[model samples]
Target chain A: MAARAARFNQQVLIDTTPLPDSIPKVKEIGATSAPLLSAAFFIGARCKPYNDDYMMCKTEANGRGELECMKEGRRVTRCAASVIADVNTHCLSEFRKHWMCLENWNQQLWQCRRFERDLNKCVFENLKLEKVIPGAPADEIPVHLRKRQIYAHSYANM
Target chain B: MPQDMPPVGGYEPIQYKRNLPARGFRPAYYLLAVAGIMTYGFYKYGKGVRELNELGREKMWSRIHLIPALQAEEDRDQVRRMLADKARERELLGAETKVYHSDRFVRPTFAVVPENTTD
Candidate 1:
């Protein structure tokens, strides 16, 4: 009986885990980008330095050995932890902007761009990360494509 | 033989005693057992009903349907076309366009920074 009950609970959870189809916007971005978008939601001043350092390692270092950028990578992880903790405390209202944006904009990143920008802006400013340029695109747009464009342009010039 | 037959008529039949062990519990104990089983059954049924009702309520409350991570073929093609168009636009621009969008960035609602941070 206990085993049966466990199976029932698992099925219920599985049912709840997927995004609903009513929001076509989420369906449009589909599954591939959802995790990235979700991660993007939490980024702010707390994680900026690490994110910047990692980007520098990736782009300037040309994807070489991370032996040079290990410190930055570690800093990013540490910053992420503290930043996540801080968000759970001070910036809940700002954080809610993303939630509200998800519901209001139907999970469209482009539409929620303002809310994400607002969240990161609010959270990071509180962490004193405002003046520094973010390594990742602070906007809702995909940063990888932009990076690729730069790479492609540079190759063409060469 | 005639004497034995005569003795038989005078002989009485011997009476035999039967012994049986007493029951440890009273009849009321059986009644209590039945009642306890019924109560357990009813409690389980009530819990099942409550769980079912909660599941129904959740279904009613959910506004969005669950969309799987996989996209439809047409949707995937659409995304590909959009990417290609963006790439073409970038190529035409020659210089990299720093601005991804025209939306004005919103300010943060909270501004209390933690100390010991380098700029």
Candidate 2:
């Protein structure tokens, strides 16, 4: 009887969503990625321009310890920093808080949870919608929200 | 073999130095070595921070511009596909590669059947 009830519950869950035929056609195209090399360059160059520049100096310029490359790297870093600054002006604290916690307590998701929540909230509120995750499960509330004690009980068992 | 020195035995008499022997390298060298190690450590730390920042920055920028840029690209590709489809449709309907100079812009001409070919 218990197994039959469980099977019936699963069937009910499956039937909750509408059929594909009934769903409206979406005109909007899904998001895509920036070119890999360009994206990687932007990221690497932005953070550590000197090192990146030094490498470029060695490879692209075919020289050793080129000061020009370092200068170019600095320029790139400055440009990236300027752009980042513009973005950061809106939610720097939130970004910092979230990123710092993530960096420090990487393996401890529970410890990082509040900071993540705060950051997500801040980003959504302050920045463009494009900056936010479109269909994040983090925002979802459980249908039968588990109590603190229930979480504690589970942790205790572990 | 000084007369005051104890005789050598299985347990040889230890010589006590009045003063410690001078180090092979100067104090300055040791200081420099320690400083070098510290500088290397700092360099490593800075590199790690930079890498971490890069990762974080990339993730954040992706959230902001990457999606929108990709969507715009997709939309453009879609439009191009639509145009291609229309061109194909026109071709099927036997529209000659008609050069209708309607405006300043010259429309792209598609492949047309030769007028002499009956088959």
Candidate 3:
């Protein structure tokens, strides 16, 4: 029975052995990370010369009379206002996408860490039980462990 | 004949004839009129006083009720700020990593020892 219990303990230890690289490290996304890289590429592709007429007017008015300066200022102000509005709209849209991505990443990381912790805890508990089994009282053995012992005995009989 | 009717003793000419009655009222009628006017005045004055009292009470109650509500609103704002700060702290500490354990049963002493021990 001692040998049998030792064998069962060994099996439990083997089953509860920690996996290599068990805990997943938190992932940090740098500037060169996929999400940021893709966002940059998307922005570069979507961006265009939005106020060509205003630019032309300013270029034509450069180093000219007072009337030209006034004209250039008006064109610049109008163009700036429109560009600001357009940028704000684009930023709002992109912000929502970025927020969702960050939220999803955070959730995934949380779940992964929780799973790793649970697995570690289970392994630790099994190790503790195996270490304590030799001095454990015969009648005081827990039902779950007793059931495992019974299963082992029956298997040995088979 | 055109004769001069000039009596030596009473030479009086009756010129005006009174047709309307006297303008003075009887005592009972005058008293009733005066009482009616006084009753109307008193009714108006009493109604005005009651309405003013009601308005004053309403204003006082409104002020009494408003102060607590405003104070409660301020207290709620403070509580909201406190909760916001706590939430910020939790966020910074990564609340998801927190462990929750409930230990219900006391672990058996023998279960924690080896059977090979003499004791």
The C-alpha lDDT values of all candidates are: 0.43, 0.41, 0.35
For candidate 2, the iRMS in Å is 20.6
Give model 3's DockQ, 2 decimals. Answer: 0.00
Pull out the clashing pairs in model 1. Answer: A19-B66, A19-B67, A20-B65, A20-B66, A21-B65, A45-A124, A122-B108
TM-scores of the models, in the order given: 0.27, 0.25, 0.22
Cα deviation of A124, candidate 1, in Å:
7.2
The best candidate in terms of lDDT: 1
Comparing 1 and 2 by lDDT, which wins?
A: 1
Compared to the true structure, candidate 3 yields what TM-score? 0.22
The runs of at least 3 residues in candidate 3 whose Cα sits more than 4 Å from the true structure, single-residue gaps closed, are A1-158, B1-13, B16-19, B23-35, B62-66, B78-119
Candidate order by lDDT, decreasing, is 1, 2, 3
Backbone clash pairs for candidate 3 read: A134-B114, A134-B115, A135-B113, A135-B114, A135-B115
Candidate 3 chain A TM-score vs. reference chain A: 0.21
Q: What value does the lDDT take at residue A138 in candidate 1?
A: 48
What would the per-residue lDDT of candidate 1 be over residues A62-141, giving only the tens digit for each residue? 65423344445445544544544566576677666665655554444334544556665776667544322233334532
True contacts kept of 2: 0.00
- Cα RMSD, each candidate: 26.0, 26.8, 40.0
DockQ of each: 0.00, 0.01, 0.00
Task: Determine which window of 10 residues in candidate 1 chain B has minimal summed lDDT.
Answer: B62-71
